[model samples]
Target: MRKRTVGTGILVACAVGLLVYLAFNVRLAPIPNAVAALKTVGMTCGSCAGKIEKALKPMKGVAGVEVDVKGGWVLVGYDTNSANPETFAGAVRKAGFQSWLMEQMSLADFRRVTGRDFGAKVVRSGGCGTGGCDSGGCGNAI
Candidate 1:
């Protein structure tokens, strides 16, 4: 009957609208023009990711933060005008996580070199030699 057709049409319209909303919200976030990829360590769970995010999100020029818990990366999008990677490293330290700036470059280069899934091959700061770290030399410079 006409009532059934009207109901079906309304259901279809709602489904399409829901899909559109998800398409925007679920899509990968756009990387900022200037990004710093920090090879993160000691971040084991979602709570750890939240700690890192809380540390970086309030920074002066930090634009975005993407934490890959499994991949062990903390991708921080920041403005070069008022932000430096050094401050970011400090924040991570305060949050009880170890992070070192692996690369500071354009979005294109970052995109080319890394992915959100496997950021395993990144170079660590490792301020100490193979002898082992003395203080916090493992994450930041000694």
Candidate 2:
């Protein structure tokens, strides 16, 4: 009985040590940028929003993503220097949607008006009439 108890204690200690080692060694990737917003088109339903969110969330440098179907926008939080904004538009395009960077003030004001919370930093923006672009504009300046 004494030997069996000592063996169990050793096993438990080993398991605990392994868990602590793994926890300390595991390194999570850092988030790349602050919050950013992109005006999107063709996201008329929940599925569309989900598809876009799925595509963008896994991208490197992207920390978090929120898709607003009603507002037709996607807000992202990331590290600016590491994040490639073009990748965001590309993901949207791949998901069969169109997207563009909304002007800083325009996005902030829109968020305020719509009562959306993203806490974005406004990395870049397209001017007036640039929101919700289609294939003709190709997610760029017209």
On TM-score, the leading prediction is 1
Q: What is the Å distance of residue 72 in model 1 from its true position?
A: 1.4
Residue-wise lDDT of candidate 1 within 58-131, one digit each (tens)? 78778788887667888888777778877887799888877888878776676666664223343233233333
Clashes of each: 0, 5
Query: Which one wins on lDDT?
Result: 1
Model 2 C-alpha RMSD to native: 9.3
lDDT of 1 at 14: 100
TM-score of each: 0.56, 0.54
The sequence of per-residue lDDT tens digits that candidate 2 reaches over residues 37-127 is: 7899766455566677788877877766777766788877666667776678788787777888763333345466657645443222332
Off by over 4 Å in 2: 1-29, 103-142
The global Cα lDDT (0 to 1) of model 2 is 0.66
lDDT of 2 at 113: 65
